[model samples]
Target: MRLDKFLKVSRLIKRRTLAKEVADQGRITINGTVAKASSILKEGDELAIQFGTKVVTVKVESLKETAKKEEANNLYSVVKEERVTAE
Candidate 1:
């Protein structure tokens, strides 16, 4: 699955366009490497997303074309959520 699509379908960013913008700005990484909006994602991949003053890390659990609200959370497992304290 594409990173942007997974982000939206998983309810991470609210919209695909927003996800794409975020990815394009280099606010997202896959497996500790910077990733683009069109990046390919697979099961078990770890993603770190920068949102405001925090970073959220999630593990890809599954991929689907579409998911209901109740099922969206099952697509990825949040591994960590930490505030990005400025040094």
Candidate 2:
């Protein structure tokens, strides 16, 4: 699955466009390397997404074309979440 689609399907981001924008801006990383919106996603891949002051890290668990609201959380497992504010 594409990184943007995985983000949306996993509910990490609200929309695909925003995911793409974030990725394009170099706010997302896969395994410590910068990733693009069209980056490929695979099981067990770790994604670190920057959202304003919060950094959300998740490991890809599964991939599907679509998921129900109840099942959305199963797609990825949040490994760590950190909040970094300006000093």
Candidate 1 lDDT over 6-27, as tens digits, reads: 9999999999999999999999
User: For model 2, how does the per-residue alpha-carbon lDDT over 1-87 read when each residue is reduced to its tens digit?
Assistant: 999998898788889999999999999999999999999999999999988999999999999989988999999899999998888
User: Local distance difference test, per candidate?
Assistant: 0.97, 0.93
Model 2 CA deviation exceeding 4 Å by range? none
Best model per TM-score:
1
lDDT of 1: 0.97
How well does candidate 2 score on lDDT at residue 82?
100
Colliding residue pairs in candidate 2? none
Span of 10 residues, lowest total lDDT, candidate 1: 78-87
Estimated TM-score per prediction?
Answer: 0.97, 0.95
